[model samples]
Target: MLLFLMSLNFMVLDNIIMLEYNLLTINSDMIVMTILLDWMSLLFMSFVLFISSMVIFYSEEYMYGDLNINRFVMLVVMFVLSMMLLIISPNLVSILLGWDGLGLVSYCLVIYYQNVKSYNAGMLTALSNRVGDVALLMSIAWMLNYGSWNYIFYLDFMKNDISMMVTSYLVVLAAMTKSAQIPFSSWLPAAMAAPTPVSSLVHSSTLVTAGVYLLIRFNFAFSNNLMMLLLFISSMTMFMSGLGANFEFDLKKIIALSTLSQLGLMMSILALGDYKLAFFHLLIHALFKALLFMCAGNIIHNMGNCQDIRFMGSLVNQMPLTCTYMNICNLSLCGLPFFSGFYSKDLIVEFLSMEYLNMYIYIMFYVSIGLTVCYSFRLVYYTMSGNFNYISLNSLNEENEIMLKGMGGLIFMVIFSGSSLMWIMFPSFYFICLPLYLKLMTLFLIMLGMFIGYEFSKFSLSYSSKSLMTMNLSFFLSSMWNMPFISTFGINYNPLKLGNFYYKNIDQGWSEYMGSQNIYMNLVNSSKFLQILFSNNLKIYLLLMVLWFMFIMFTLF
Candidate 1:
């Protein structure tokens, strides 16, 4: 721990010294920064460090009996380093390089459990991530071919032509996939195969936030069709994930789905061009989510990896410290007043009011928040308030001292930093902070969710499992309206089938067209030069061609 602090101090000192010497200057196409120091980046970096340390500390105790402690420690440090680099990156390419490193490390860590389930989950995440990575690469290639590779490239692409439109759509698709937005949201819930500490780091604090960060950073490109796409995608993702979380039985998967839901909310806020709200929510979500995942970890570790909350009950008595921390974190998740979530949640709604079309979005956002409260409270109550029916595998059952201390310290940090940092970031938030009526409204919604969750606890399932519920009713309802204005309304709903329908019914003049093309095909096929060019000696042909050009040049001289 001392060595870790010293390393942090050295990085800070290096950055300070570089700034003092004016060693890092802003390019003409770059945003000015004092050695790339900015309030937002600094704040995000602080969260990364805090959470990474807590997770490391937690793992020291959580994995004490496992043989792979060294491996875990190495991956944890690499994770921290990669996130720090990503947070401070000054250019898009540099940011992407950092992001790739982060994805690689996170994928490796998610499967650290080395079980079949974890292995499959890790592969699924990597596969989805590869799709996003390819999209990003294509976008980068397009941007470099047209606009400059500097920061101005994003600024210049807003009014560019058709290519820019295609590139922008591709980027939005990639961002949604990376952030685990709807349709691509299944990977995250399955990612619960990871241990709780890794889940906390990836889902809550670092990698999942990358998509929102990219969207907010590239708001200059939000002008064209991209804005509408983001709004729809974000709305659908939030609405669906909220319902998904409601039905999930695993304690970890519930939080995982909630992460996707909250990320969707942040994306929607960004779609409205409210950068502050998006970033503010990112910070608050990171805190509460990290705390909650750690608490879940504590519960699971104590129960010898019994993941279903259906079997966990009356934990408040057996694990008072974990319960207290869980309650506070749950309150934050529930968005109770004076907690961290309250400030950010309210601010986002206020920002929504400023947009014309955003009122409906605000309604949906609040509904999702209510759902968030419901799932969060359900998670806490089900795992802590029921009868203690669970049996510990080890007779001398207790949380590791190191793990408890780590978790307790993280909970304290969340409480302290959550409120104070909000004030520091946006002092204006202090005055317009939810009015008495709005506070009551928000509180009422939260209480309604708690009531539902409380009622839900009375009815128990005979058998419950952690994998995500096979189907989501809310998702079906929300997506039923997405047929593109000509399918169910006037055209075909199945795009692929439409292609086959066209081939079967249209273009009956195929033979005449083929006959006309035969002469051209024969002329090309009869060319000896072309035949030679297609031979394996194609490289030699190219060499002879170059020599002929040289001979022609000599004769002219």
Candidate 2:
């Protein structure tokens, strides 16, 4: 809380406080650790600290009687510390400490449930981010050419040098995998298998946003061509997640998909040369998404660990406060007018429209926005409306004040954070002048998506299900473009097959044919031949001894 408040102070002052420590000097090269205390780092640090604190507080009710509560809290603390390290450091070498810490801590958090699902999700999360870690390590190596590792001073100047910009490409790759963009997006939804608080924090900012934040910090290094490439990938990621969420039924996974979509938005905007707007969206997104996850955790708890939306219905009757919280967060997620999400999201869309982009990019941007609204409303219909669908014996009420209080702590922020952040982050307004239709297009899409979602949710009217018609297409969308299959089977299948072949053909088959077994047979055959020679020699010596004895006896006579 103190750190969060301090961020406001830092933002108002408009000053960057950089602290440098020369850790070592070898020959002419020096190893200096740098801490940058600009508004961006401070603000981001404060947001992380705030969200982590709330998550810890919320876990008191969520993790109530767990045996390893202390261990869980410690891991969360470690995660927060790593995020702080990541936010403050300007040097790539020092930043690795935080970068790797997030990966390790998140894996621990993801596997906390002690189930096969949790373990699988944890491995996917860890291994997917490993790609980014390797990319960052490579980027650090490239940055060594800049003499000093503090890239803050050099990224802008080095953008022109093609040789030096290899660091830029590596940085982009790291950001892509870290943010779970396109090819790497499968892990984001899989991470939903983690505990809700972990999902809330990780999805909000700690793990996934690490890439976007890093890119925001390194935005100056991206050339136009690089930015164009990033924009395309980010746009696709946004579209893919939105499509996936609509097809998704699992409550937490849908929210997780929403997180992925928003991340794509942040990255796309960052690529479009508005790092500050991206930061604004990032901060506001952290607030509402965290709250959304908490609400999800509460609902899942009440439903007796049931996370499928189809099993939830008329929740508003029993848990009005939670339902309300969930709806507000969902609305915020949809960028509803006057909501916290709208402040940042609206500005981003307007700014994007102002840019000179091609047809494909433009179409993706609006279509993704519509899909986001469609999914949110679809989720609303499934979980909140219709008849009571949950078990009648179960107790589903909002008696858990600890959870509510933790959630309440962020309600004010989720509602008003947009305008407040806009004032602080962007004191100057962007001049967005478009004809009335372009401005109204966002509203039109929202209405259209809401209608479509309502129609789509009414699946009972037609027993002949539409998904049954094109099962392949639905599967493709729901699986995040078959990325999970590719990440798991496509990647592991060949290596595993080759390993099996080697074990059968070489270790078992060839060893018996020409290795140890063959060597033993050869040894036995050689010994038998030598034995035959010795036996023959023995017989010959015996005969010679008899002949000599006979000759001696005759001579003596």
Candidate 3:
């Protein structure tokens, strides 16, 4: 553990020392500082090392019996290195390189279990991350045409308009895809098939954050006109993921969605130009999220791989230490008072209440925060309390004492850290403190969620066909909340049958527009053009011959 910490520090120093030449610098005309290592990036970097180190120590015990422990450790190290490289890279090109490497490392780590489901999840993550990379690459390619690509490198990117309208839109798409926003979020839920430590790293401090980090890296390009777009998209992501988390049954999926929603909150803060608040929240999230994920891993390890919370209950009595740590972490995630998440989460809300932004955005932020509390508590209750039907009491074995000790240490540190220990250690990092009453209010929300969650657990869940039918009926009824007419008149009705009845005489009508994603796929796979251009080696040879002939003719002429 000491060696690991030392190595982590060494890695940070190596990066700073090696990349010193290309360190951040300001652009000549831009108002933003060109190259600056403000508190935000530094703070995020600190969290990365902190959470990653925790993962390594926890895994020492968690993966003790596994055969591929060395590979796991190596990949974990590589993953950290890749993320650091991405975070500290000087130019857009280096950023892309590191980003791609991080993506690949994460995919490899996800499938480390070597099962069909794990492989499938890894593939999904890869495909989605590829979409993000393609957007980033396209932006880089655009910069190539304008001669400004090299001029705005590293932290210096803050000083130039490297992103034009098209590039900005593309980068935003990349951010959405990378952050698992909206429709692109399907990949993250599936990503639950990975080991829990990987989930912690992916969710808390690493893979999922690359896109938002990039956005922050180029804040100058976005600070003026795109604030509204960023805010709307981010808040909507928070709202959607929070609601979706409420509906999730898988423990890791719930946490994964929570990760996305929290990141959306950070993005929202960034959009509002509250970089300090966003940075603090990002740091605080790393602490609580890592704690949460590690606890989940312990649960999975102890319960012999159970995932669905519907089957779990009475675990608090069985694994008291695990339960205690998990509960505290859950409280933090719910933004309870004196927990790290409280101050950070409230700070974001405070920024949103600044009156210049749309009132609804502020409302949505609070609603999402409340829903965040709801789902986070739901995660704890469904997994930790109730009937012990799902968990095999006979089969359950408490995790190693060392693992439990690590979790305990984290909880204690976060509690003290949240209070004032961390502030004493780094006074410069503290931006603005929350009011005591506001902190109490944050705890009130958490306590409210705890009560609601407790009430929910008292009712025995019935999986009988009748109960399932009721659930289906309820879901069908509630689906109308978002777009009532679409749910009632369009989706519930068989569009295929309706179109068949009407367009039976008319060729494909709605399907044409409906399959635009497929159309994009088709355009991407246009083999006919490839065939005409290079299907045969003869075509390539002939083209080469013509080019040579033209060259000779031009020389002679």
Scanning candidate 1 in windows of ten residues, the lowest lDDT window is 480-489
Give lDDT per model, in order. Answer: 0.73, 0.89, 0.71
Error of 1 at 549 (Å): 68
User: Candidates sorted by TM-score, descending order?
Assistant: 2, 1, 3
- lDDT over C-alpha atoms for residue 107 of model 1: 85
The candidate maximizing lDDT is 2
Instruction: Residues 1-557, candidate 3: write the lDDT tens digits.
Output: 44334334553454332223434546753222123243344556666877788888888888888999999989988988888767665356767777888889888998998999889778877887788889988988876656554423432444345546557667777877878776576677777887788787888888888777877766656646677888887888788877767766778888888897898898888888765556567667777788888888898887778777887877888788888888887777777766777667765665555447666896688778777888877777776766687623456657478777667657765665454523432345535455776545545666666676566545645567457776875454223123323423353479767778776443455655457656866777887667666767797898899999999999999
**What are the TM-scores, per candidate, against the unseen true structure?**
0.75, 0.93, 0.73
Model 1, 401-464: lDDT tens per residue? 8878888777766677567656556645433545666646766788888888777667654434
Measured over all alpha carbons after superposition, the RMSD of each candidate to the real structure, in angstroms, is 12.7, 3.5, 13.8
Please state the error at residue 369 of candidate 2 in Å: 0.9
Better of 2 and 3 by lDDT: 2
Predicted candidate 2 versus true structure: per-residue lDDT over 1-557, tens digit per residue: 66666777877777788998888999987777889998788888878888888999999999998999999999999999998899999988778899999999999998998899989989999999999899889988877676777888888877798645888898889889888998999888888877888899999979989999999989998898999999999999999999999989899999999999999999999989999999899999999999999998999998889999999888889999998998999889888899989888888888888998888988898899899999999988998899888777998889999999999998998898888878877777789999999998888888888888888888743445656658778778898988999999998999999999988998889776799889999999999998887889988788889999999999999
| RMSD after Cα superposition, model 3 | 13.8
